[model samples]
Target: MINKLYFTSLDEQVQQKAFRAIEEEQRSIGYYTLPDQDITPILSYCDSIPDMIETIAVIGIGGSSLGAKAIYEFVKPLNNLSRKLYFFESTDPINITTLLSKIDLEKTHFLVISKSGNTVETFSIYKYIYSLQNDPSAYTFITDPDSPLEKYANEINASVLHLPDNVGGRFSVLSTVGLVPLALCDIDIQALLNGAQTIKQSFFNDGYLKDTLLKKAVFYAKNHAQFHINCIFAYSETLKYFCEWYVQLWGESLGKHQRNSAFHVGLTPIGLIGPKDQHSFLQLIMEGTRDKSVTFIKIEDFHDNITISDITLPHLETLDILNGLPFSKLINMQCDSVMEALEVQGDIPLDSITIPTVNEHSIGSLIYYYELLTSLVGELIDVNTYDQPGVEAGKIILKKKLRVLKK
Candidate 1:
C-alpha cells in the first residue's frame, strides 16, 4: 500500500533544526493542517452543483490551477466521473480561443481560484468568461477572504470559498483551491486528505520517518552548492503533470534570498517524464553538468496488464522476446535500467519514490511529501518559503505596463 515515505539520513543538529521549522510552519502557515480541516464545506458545495453541469473549467494559473489540474489528469482515466475537467491557465489568445470552443458554457461550471484574488491573468480570464455568460450561479470563487475577487463574487452574488490566509497558492492544493473542483468531479477528496494525513502523522508522530524526511531536506540544503538542480524523473504518463506541479512547488518555495544574508539560495527543480525522456534528457543527465540530483518516481501497479501481441515480421523477429510482455513491465525496467546506469556512473545524489498506485490517497500523500520537503529545505536554507517576492515584483511591472498602454 506504500503507507509511508522513507528517505536518507541526516545529522542531529540538522534534524533538530528541521523539526523546529516544521513546528513553526505548522503554527503559522497552516498548510500542514489543511488535511485535518472539515471538508463539509467542499462537500456541501459539490452537492449544490447543478445537475446539468457536465464540465468543470478551473480558471487560474501557477499555484491556482496546477495542483488541481495535475490531480484531475493523474486519476481521470481510473474513474469515469460524470463531469469533465479542464484548465484555463494561460492568457495566450490561441489557448483561450481553443479551450473556449471545446467547452459549452451552459454545461460548464467555472471555479475561479487565486490565493491573492487580484492575480491579473486569473481576473482577465474570469472577466472574459463573465462577459460571455454573465451568470453568477455559473461560477464559484476561491480565494483569500476579503480580497477584491471575493468582493466581486459577493457583488455578483456568486458562491465564494475562502482559503486560509496563511496558506500560499502552491501550498493550498489540499485546501479549497484543489478540493472544490476535484470534489465536484467525484474525486475522493476525503481519501486524498486521509492519504496526506497519513504522511503528516508519519512525519510528526513517528520518529523514523521524521528523521528520514528531515535527512533528505538536510542533504539538499547542505549540498545546495554542489547539487543545485533537483531533477524529478517520474516514469508514468499519468504523472507528467504531477512533475510540473512539483516543479512549481519546489522552485517557488525554495528559491529565495537568505533570511538574514544577501546571498540567494535555492534548488532548481526539473520535471521529466521517463522512458519518453530517457532517449533525450538522459544523455544530458549522464554526461552533462555534474550539479544535478535525481529523484525517480515509479508506479508499482497500473491495475492493467495488457500484453503485447506475439507477432514477428521476418526482419523484426528479434523483437519477439517482448511480444508477450506487459508494457508496464517494460517501462519499469526502463526506469530501473536508468537508475542502474546512474548509480554505476556515480557522483549524482539519487533517490527514488515508488507509488503503489495512483489513487486519491497516494496522490494526496505524494503532494504533502513534496510540500513538506520544500518547507524543510527552505528552513535549512534560511528563507521565507511561503512568499514569492520575485514573482510579485514582475507582476507590479506588468500592471504598470498594461495601465500605461490602456491610458
Candidate 2:
C-alpha cells in the first residue's frame, strides 16, 4: 500500500503542530460516502453499443477527462476496451486536429462529459466534432440535468447521463464520468468499483482519523507550512497520468483563498516520471531546495519482463556486470539508490507507496487512496475541498475577454 513519514525541526521559537482539525460537517466525501449498489445500467449501455462505433472520443477536461484518461492509459495496454479511445481535453486546435486526423467520423462515437454542462472547452470541442456530422445519435452527453449540455442533448436527440449533485468532477472518478468512458472501452467498471468499495470499507470502517490514508494526510498537513511543495514522482510510465490526476486533487482541494485570519493555504504539487527525470530534476531535488517532500511510486510486479543476455565486451569488463539483469531490477535499483541518497545522504524528507502490481485492482485502490487522502487533507486544513472558485474566476475572465473581442 502507501507509506509516509513526518517530523518537525527548529532552532528557536515554538515547535507546536499548526494544523486545524478537519470539520466532518463541511466535508463532501462523496466517493466513499455514496455506495455504488448497481452498475447494470452502465454495463447494459456498453453491451448494447453498435458495431460501427470504433472510436470513443472522450470530450471533457480536468476532472471530466483526467480520471478517465488515467484509467485508460493504465488499462489500455491490457487490450481491454470495446473501442479505441481519444480525448479532446482542451480548446487547443492542435489536439483537436491531431486526433481528428486519425479518427473516422462515421465510425466514431462521442462521449461528451462535463459536470457543469457549460464547460467552454468541452462544448467547443463537441460543436467542432458535431459540425462534421450533424448526427445527434452519435453523441452521448454526461452532465447535470437542466444544464446547458442536457438541454442541447435533448434538442439534438443525443443520449444523456446525469452526474449527481453531491459528486464534483474531481471526485466523480468512480461515477459515470469515468465508468462510462472505461466501460465503453470494455474495461471492468465493476472491478474498478469493487476496488473502490473495498478501499472505502477499509477506509471508513478502519477508523476515520486513524485510517492509513488519513495518517499520510496528517504528515502532509503537519508539514504544510514549511515543506509546501508535494512532489509525486512516479517510477512507472503507466503512473505518469496518475500524477497529473493527483496534483489537481491536492492543489484544488487545499488551496483555499481566505482561512485562519487571511492566511492562504495550499501545497504546490509537482509531478515527474522517472528514471527519465533523473537527468533533469534529480539534481535540483537532491541539492537545490529542501522545501519539497518527495514520494516515489514503485511497482513491484510488471507484466513485461526483459533480461540482458550474455554480452561479451572484452575491452569493457566493467560493463559486463549489467549482463543477466532484468529491466525491472534496473528500475527498482535506481529508485532504491536515489531514495537512499535523498534520505540517508541529503536528509531530504521522502517515502514511497509500493504497489504490488499494476492491475485493475491496484489502480482502483490508488485512485480511492488519493481521493480519500485529498478529502482528509482538506478537512485537516478546515477548507471546503470540493469547490474550485479559483478556476471559476479564470473562466469568468476568459469569457469577459472573449466578449470584449466580439465588440
Candidate 3:
C-alpha cells in the first residue's frame, strides 16, 4: 500500500528540531510505548462468537471518543459490518433525546470511556443509558486503573479495561480505549497494530530524521507565529470524522503557555470537508486573512468506480466534456480544482496526504503519524505536550458552577 504524503516547506533546521522531539518520545513510557504492546486483550473481549452484540454505543467526548469514532468512520463502510456503532458525545439535550430514541437497549452494548473517571459529560450520558438498559451486563468501561469509573464498573459487574495512567486521552487511541470499540465492530485489530508498528519501526531506521512526522512537526513549529491555525480538509466522506479527531489532537496538545513566559504556544486546528468547504469556507480562506495553513487529505482508491455515461440533452452539448467520467474521477477532479485555485490565489501554505485505501492499516498508520508528529511539534515549540492544565482549569470552573446547582 502506497501512502503518498506531501509536506511543504521543511529545511534542515526543521528536521533537526523534530528529530530531537522524536528522541524524547522514544525515551517516554506511555504513548510512544504502544507499538511494542499486544492487542489480544481488547480483541478477544470484543469478539462476536460469545457476545453476539448487535450494536455498540460509545459515550464520551473529545479524545475519549474521537479517535475511535474516526477509525470507525473510515473502516465501517469498507467492511461488511456485523455490529452497528453509535456515539453520545455531548451533554446537549437534543443529541441525547435523538440518540436515545434510535437505540434498542437489548442488543446494544455500551462503551463508557474516560481517561479520568470524573468527566461530567461521560457519566451523565452513561447514567442516562444505564437507566434505560434492561441488560446492563453488556456495558463495558475503559479508563485508568483504580479510577472512579473502573470502581463503578466493578460495582455494576461490568467488564473494565484499564488505560495506562500516563497515556493522555488524545494519545490513548492505539491503546485499549480505541481498540476495544474497533474490535467490537469486526475491524482487523492486528493489521491496524501492524501498521502502527511500521511507523514505530521507521523511527529507528538510518534516516529517521528525514521521516514524515519529523518534517511535519518542523513545519508547524517553524510557522506557528504567522500561521496560528491549521485548517484540515478531508476530501473523502469516510475521513470527515478524522478531521474532528485531529482538532482535539492538535489543539489540546499544542495549545499551552510557554515556560515561565507571558506568551503561549498553540496551533488552532479547524476541520473541514473537501468540496463542501470549497464552496463555503474557501471563499474566506482564499481571500480572507493569511493566518492559516491548509492540509488536504484524499483517499487514493474508492470501492465504487462506476463511470458517468455520456449525457446528451437538447441544450447540453457544452457538457459533453463530462462523458465517461467516473464519479471517483469527478470527486478527485474537484479536489484538484480547489487545490489549483488555492495555489493560484491564496497565500495559505499547504500539505497534502494521500492514503492508498481506507482500511484498518492505513487508518492506524495515520493515527500513529499524528500522535508522533504532535509530540514532536510539542518539542519544537519547547513546551510540555503531555499535560492539559488549561483544560483542568475549565473543569475547576465547572465544579464550582455545578456545585451551585446542588446548593
Candidate 4:
C-alpha cells in the first residue's frame, strides 16, 4: 500500500539484478523468524523486572549500544517515564570511572550485550563491573548460546539470553540485542517488530522497481559514484543515535573488496535538534564545498505541544498577519520551505523520511528499512555485508600498543 519510489538513473537490467541479489541474501538470513525466538524471553524478562530498577545502564560497544541508544531516545518522549538510562561502550578509563561514580551499581540493572561474548571493550567493562560488584546477580548477559558470557551468567546466577548466530550485530536490534534494553526503557518492542514486519511484507510483495529498499539502494549507488560522502542529519535529539547506528551499519557492511572491484563506502552523521543548528551548521551546509548527500529525518510530533500567542510590537501594533499558526507547525513548515529553497539553489539532493509517530513500531520499521537498504547497497557494490575484517585489525593494533605501554 505504500507508494514506492525508484531511482531515475538506474537501468532496468541493473535494477533487476540488484533486487534478485537482495532477495536471495535476505531470504538466506531468514529475516522473519530470526528475532522471534529471542523476542518473547526478552519481553517477558523486561516485564518481570521489579520497579526496583530505578536506573539502568547498558554496557557494550558498536551495534550493541547504538541500537538501544536509538530506541531509548526515540521512545523516551512518548512514555514520559522518569527512569534515567545510560549507556557505557567506551574503554576510556575516565569515561567508565565517571559513569560508575554517577550511578549506584548495586541499585542499577546492567545489561551486557555482545553477540560473540568476547568483544574486548564489552569484556573489559564487564570485568571492571564484576570487580566492583558485591553482588554479581545485578548483571545480565545477552549473547550467543553456549558462549562464555552465557556460561558466566549461569555461574553467577545472573540472567542470560541467547543471540542468533546468523544475525549480525547491526541487524540484531529486533532481537534481544535491541528488545531488552528498549523494553526496560518502557518502549513497546512488539510494535517495533510489527513495523519491521510491515516493511518486510512490502519488500516481499512488491516488484524490484517498486521496492522501497531497492530504490534506496539504487539511489545511493548512483549518487555514490559522484559524491562519496553520505551524511545523515536527524532533526530530533532522540534520533541522534539512530544516525550513529546507521553510520556503522552502512559503513561496515559496504566497505570491502569484491572479485570485480574494490568497494569504498563512508558515512558521516550529524544530529540537529531543530532551529538550534540553523545558526550553527546551516551556513556551512549551504555554502561549504563538499561532495555529500544529506538525509533529514523529522518526527511529526513531540512531547511538548506548541501554543499560539499574540504579541504586538510597538511599530507593528496594527499588523495582524503573524498571529495564526501554531509555533511547532510554523517551525516545521519554515524548515521544509527553507530546505526546498536550498535544494533549488544549491542543487543539493535531499531525502525526507517522516514518521507518523515515534514508537517501537516506527523505530523497528526505520531500523529494518535501513538494514535492508544497506544490504542492497552492499550487494550492488559486490561487498560482504556481514563481515568486518578491518575493525578487528584496529583492535589487534591497539592490543600491541597496550602491551608496550604496560611496560
Worst 10 residues of 3 by lDDT: 1-10
Number of residue pairs clashing in candidate 1, backbone atoms closer than 3 angstroms, sequence gap of 3 or more or interchain: 0
Residue 380, candidate 4: alpha-carbon lDDT: 72
lDDT of 2 by residue, 1-407 (tens): 54545333331111112112333432544556434648888888877668878988889999998888888898777565668888899888987899999999999888889877888888788888878978887888999878888998898788999886578888888888888888887887787777666667776565442344555666677678887888887888998888888888888888996455577888888998889999998898888767788888888887778888768787888988899999888898998888888886555668787877777777887888778778767766667788889999999998999899999
The worst-scoring run of ten residues by lDDT in candidate 1 lies at 1-10
The reply for model 1, stretches above 4 Å from the true place, is 1-10
Compare the candidates by lDDT and give the number of the best one. Answer: 1
What value does the lDDT take at residue 359 in candidate 2?
Answer: 73
Report, for every candidate in turn, its global Cα lDDT versus the true structure. Answer: 0.88, 0.78, 0.80, 0.72
Model 1 deviation from the true structure expressed as Cα RMSD, one decimal place: 1.7
lDDT of 1 at 399: 95
lDDT of 4 by residue, 152-194 (tens): 7888888888776588888777777777777787776777888
Question: What is the per-residue lDDT of model 3 for residues 375-402, given as tens digits with 9 covering 90 to 100?
Answer: 8788888778888899899999998998
Model 4 quality (TM-score): 0.88
- What shift in Å separates residue 194 of candidate 3 from its native position after superposition? 1.9
Q: Alpha carbon lDDT of residue 349, candidate 1?
A: 80
Q: 2 or 4: which has the higher TM-score?
A: 2
The Cα error of candidate 1 at residue 26, in Å, is 0.9
Clashing pairs in 2: 22-379, 81-185, 82-185
Q: Write the per-residue lDDT of candidate 1 for residues 205-262, one digit (tens) a residue.
A: 8644576677788988889998999999989999889999999999998899998999
TM-score of 3: 0.93
